[model samples]
Target: MEPNPDREPGIPTDLLGVARIAGQSLRHIVGAVTKGAVHTATDLVDDIRSGEPISQIFDERVDLFRRAALSALGLTSTETGVPVETKVDAEDLKAMGDAMITEGWDSAQQPRELHPSFVPILHDLTPDEARILRFLAVAGPQPAIDIRTKAPFGIGSQRLADGINMIAAMAGCALPDRDHHYLGNLSRLGLVRFSTEPVADFRRYAFLEAQPPAQAAYRSVKMRAISSYRSIYLTVFGKQFCDACFVLGDYTGGGWAGDDRGDIYLGKGPRLP
Candidate 1:
């Protein structure tokens, strides 16, 4: 048996051949051997031809160990842009959290103090919900209410409409019809909430109560409309999120901010529980 002068066993001689094999291997990657193996294979082939240690080629498996080691140490593909992640365990989670805390305590550099959960929260939000949050962030607590019909004995009062507000129209949401659903999602994410108490300006309720949803609820009832008034506003956590993520305008002339960038829009409203 004679070895081909241009080729080796179990290894491709041409770069294309190496890329093809690496592509196939990547598509059918077994147990995540780290990414960007093809480039490593090609470079290694050159190194082998240049009289470098032939055993190095075998040991690295065409840069497999180097990549896998880097991946294991949480280094991503900034150099080559082909990255991978290894399966992490509970201990890994604990270590990451502890490392984050330590990073937070370091006073040398200005670390982004945004909560880690904010990233996932952004993924969970709909565009409409985001608009609503942006609006609430600036507009302050908008009036909302439960429309109910009072009974003679007050025991059989029926709710005509629940959690009605002008957020959809005010926020300029694309789908005003899904306002309730969007509010529900925001509430679920702890971004917004209905306060038990109402806003300082009681006049706001008149405008909200005059809205179509409220009027329809009133029209449906033969009895007088009993408005259970409340105000919807962002929680402190939500305010922080909006501050970091949204570009808001300083509509109110209260002068809360140091610069003309944007005002922190916590209006003159009662604090939430």
Candidate 2:
């Protein structure tokens, strides 16, 4: 993790009770990386012959483990190791743990398919942003206009802070106060993409017809037509994230995974038909 600007070197002021917790919190992280692989038997025998304490070796590896965990969690760290004053928030730690379980281990203590790529995806997202991804995982691609129109939370009034808080109260999870901003964040993550016209690249995905009443309301407020309607679709990276990190139940068969989008970058999208 990056050094906390407010804390002194070697200080233990993080939300997870300081550096000691790294031993426990990062065990799975190390295990996933090593995947129970071991060095040659001759090398192990040589180490024993040299009288190097295996326990000491493990302790040294634990430091490496901690640094790896922090990196996977998208926290900044030096090539050598975690900074002495690095700090991580509780929410970020929780998200990291969730990612570890989803990508590393399963309930039966069996090794599941590991997706190291998903770690950064989970680490970089806020809880609200992650919730939006999970929603899209099952909900599939939705029209930007419908998100602001027909859905219950889509109503313009719900964009207010208080309205968003109220929705959170019932749903038990916070949502973005402004839908456009939320979608923008997702776009920044390269998980979701948007288009104003029915582009051929995403033509197979659903299109949203702007409601006349909603268009009228936007006109009354002098909202630009271009901003008033859009088609939102998940990129290939987004679908892979949802598959690795979420449960999609029976929804499959080119629904979320339409076609190869290659590697999506910030502000860049696939060519349209």
Candidate 3:
């Protein structure tokens, strides 16, 4: 089955609460890819037939394809008024199609909305960065120092119980270095920030703070002064980005604390036990 050009994918309201691009724009991308690669184009069309929402198939990276299509349409960026040069190669087209499939693009609905400030960031984000954003969106506004805990155990042991450490380990980067690298990139992109003030709602995160083992661990150690720590949080832009893009709903119970490492970590969900 093919996607109906007249309808938009049915995205969850909570997920759609953030901004998104118009369904027309996505259709334009699909049309453009169809002009080139039939296989890649069919990947998106197949999802549309399966009744998947376009939101599932797109991320911030969609901005790139949108810009390219706009350029083809002879549209210019409102900010610069310069014609966007959308010269895509075969590789890029394939990648865009793959991203749509990966994002679960469905053809159940035809949407016509477009986010006003949907500009691609300076650099492409890594899976590690996406992981960090998802974590912050769930169990963030945490101390930077707590993430610095380098508890060494066997490779299979629980190496990353702390949220910050989990992000670092997943990215294959280490502390301070991870902060300076991935975190730094996220900061520049306005997706994340390092600050002393708590951005996450205290009431929303009370359960995590109230966990018995976590409290016992804090009680067992003489932690540094609160003033000495900085917390990492998703900025408003980051939150919107996550909503419009990544499949954050797949995250369960802040599953980042699980014993799984590498690729299996995010799949394990939050470690409530």
Top lDDT model? 1
Candidate order (TM-score): 1, 2, 3
Candidate 2: C-alpha RMSD after superposition: 14.8
TM-score of 2: 0.40
Instruction: List, residue by residue over 1-273, the lDDT tens digit for candidate 2.
Output: 443353333423322322243333323433322212212222333453588754444433433443444444444444443443346566656655665555444354333454444665576677766666666666455444422322344444321111011111111246544555666777888998775643344332222234343445445533332223345667888888877887667544333334455654344456553
Leading candidate by TM-score? 1
TM-score of each: 0.54, 0.40, 0.35
Compose the digit string of candidate 3's lDDT tens values, residues 1-273: 343343324321111221233223344445443233434445645765688876676543333444444433334354433333445666766665664554345554234333433334522676666666666776545444322222334223331224332345433343423545777888888888777554332332344445443455455545421111335777887878777775666664245434243432233324423
In candidate 1, which residue pairs get closer than 3 Å at backbone N, Cα or C atoms, i.e. clash? none
Q: State model 3's lDDT.
A: 0.47
Candidate 2 lDDT trough over 10 residues, lowest sum:
159-168
Give per-candidate clash totals: 0, 2, 14
